[model samples]
Target: MTIAWASFTPWLALSGGVLIGLSATLLWLGMGRIAGISGIAGSLFSLKAASGDRAWRWLFLIGLIAGAFIVHLLTGGLFEVRSGYPIWLLVGGALLVGIGTRMGSGCTSGHGVCGLARLSMRGLVATLTFMGTAFVTVFVIRHLLGFGGSA
Candidate 1:
């Protein structure tokens, strides 16, 4: 309900958004591929994927990890892992996300960024569903369940 004024970084957030958009656009333009991380990663090791396809997927995944590492190093550990949440909870959440992505036929990056950019109706519906679910979940956790604190 309230903003975390101390942690607010609008400029950084805007910059990050721009970078994501730029990278997605570039990937589309250059390779004629959608920058759907989940799809790319999910098919990376599949027998259906060609050897050349696997190489790009590996590079993309590696670039994601490397980018985060580079930022962490540059900021001297600006990002810190939050404690308090149990490992099982985190793992469960990840598994649920993976399942959800599979069930939905694509992840947020695929449906939201690429699909929406192409003016696809499916993308709009998927994005709305994703956002609506997220809002409800946060509301339940913070207000009804009294789990997460106002951050």
Candidate 2:
């Protein structure tokens, strides 16, 4: 494998990472809630949840979408996201991710970032499992199945 140095934007990546961390930190400090996408989204589907309980979750999701739009506006369509997978494949992948997050109790933002920051053992284990699974899956798909470049 070769590095695509021309396409790499370390500064932008670093800034995004910093922003994510800061947002997670602020959410924890201000709201005392984990920045877990699954948990936040799932709460809205619960019939037992009060309207007040659902408000923040709705806002958080809305903010996420709005933030992407704001970024697109600010950058003048600079960010280009490309995918070779068909719509069915993309949908399937999303479904798998949702299942995985449900099974794992939290998503990457929760376990990998906030959980680890709090030094929770479960977070460490979850993060390891997530990373290991990703590594193995990528290796199998790319090398074993010979589906590297086409993807």
Candidate 3:
């Protein structure tokens, strides 16, 4: 394998990581909530949740999407994540993720970030399980099934 030095950016990557960590920390510290996309999305329609909280969550989610759009516009080039799948399939997959997040009680951000940071045993188990499953899926797709359609 060959690495392109011009495209390699350790400092920028580190800065992005630091920004994400800081954002998660601030969210948790200020809101007393885990910075989990799944939970935040779910809370939008949660009648039991306070409307004021939901309003903030909605704005945050919108800003996340808007930020990505803005970056795509400002940057000349961005990662072209090609998925050789139909829009319907993508929508279906997203719905499945939503359901899974609800059933799991928390998504990766919640478990991987807040849970693990707090040294919760369940978080460790969940994170390991998620990682293991992801590894197995990739292996199966790339090697066993030879599904090189797209990533």
Q: What is the C-alpha RMSD of each candidate to the true structure, in Å?
A: 2.0, 2.1, 3.1
Weakest 10 consecutive residues of candidate 3 by summed lDDT: 142-151
State residue 1's C-alpha deviation in candidate 2, in Å: 5.3
Measured against the true structure, the TM-scores of the candidates, in listed sequence, are 0.88, 0.86, 0.79
lDDT of 2 by residue, 25-56 (tens): 88889989889888788667656688888889
Q: Model 3, 1-151: lDDT tens per residue? A: 4578988989979987677778789888987877888788887866778876778898879988987788788985478778675675468657877877788867788888778988989888888887888788767866787665533
Query: What is each predicted model's overall lDDT from 0 to 1?
Result: 0.85, 0.85, 0.78
Q: Is candidate 2 or candidate 3 better by TM-score?
A: 2
Pull out the clashing pairs in model 1.
none
RMSD of 3: 3.1
In angstroms, how far off is 72's CA in candidate 3?
Answer: 2.2
Top candidate on TM-score is 1
